[model samples]
Structure formats: structure tokens, C-alpha cells
Target: MSQPPLLLTVGEIARRLDTKVHRIEYVIRSRRIEATGWAGHARVFSEANFDHIASELIRMDADRHPSTRSNG
Candidate 1:
């Protein structure tokens, strides 16, 4: 027998990201965020994959923001 894959529901993801369920749903449906899961109503996200995507998003956000340089 094969073990079930570790997957995260939309609600779980929302809790992790500290966002609302609607926002997560929006991201998933709009394809604004990268994710892998079954098609249709049985969608699920792998914890590893979601972590990777979230990390990338954080990095991208930091890159887009300019660093403040101060003269001593």
C-alpha cells in the first residue's frame, strides 16, 4: 500500500500565510500563484511545494523593494 501524500487544504494555507481563505482561493483560481494539485474540486497543495513557492514570493518581494542606504 502507498502512503497518502502530504497535502494542505486552502484553509490551512490561509492560516500559514496569515491571510483569509478567500485570498487563497483567489490566488489558486486566478493562477496568480504557482501550485500543484488535482483538477476541479479536489485540489490540494503539497506542503513542500507551497513552502518553496512562499519562499520564492518572499525573495521576490525583497528584491522589488529598494534597500535604504545611510551615510555614517
Candidate 2:
């Protein structure tokens, strides 16, 4: 069986998403997205969950900016 991907830290994810660490915590608390462990101490994200969160954010941004929509 294939091994699971490693978890991601809050700071790492925030840096990648170009957002504040607090925003990450807010998402976790609100359950807008699921994550593993706590923040600063043991916070981490699965590859699938991270991708899911990223996709959701992208979709939200697209919805906010109709001009960015593609013809296809």
C-alpha cells in the first residue's frame, strides 16, 4: 500500500496561500475545512484536505471576480 502524504504546518500553508496564520485557524475552527491536530503545537493537514481547501478558496475567488472567468 502507498504511504500517506506528510502533514503541513499552519505557517507553511499560510505562506503558500499568502494569508495570515489566524485565517487558517479560523477555517479550522469554523470547520470550513477539516484538518488534523492543533495549531503551533501539532497542526497539520493531509494532502487531500489541503487540495480541497485550496480548490474551495480558488472557487470562492472566481465567484467574487466574474471578470476572471474563462470562455471555456
Best by lDDT: 2
**For residues 7-65, could you state the per-residue lDDT of candidate 2 as single tens digits?**
88877877888987886776656656656766577668887767776676677678899
In candidate 1, the residue pairs with backbone N, CA or C atoms under 3 Å apart (3 or more residues apart, or in different chains) clash, namely: none
TM-score of each: 0.49, 0.67
lDDT of 1 by residue, 6-56 (tens): 887777777888877875676566555555676477667887757764665
Report the number of the highest-TM-score candidate.
Answer: 2
Q: Report every candidate's CA lDDT.
A: 0.67, 0.74
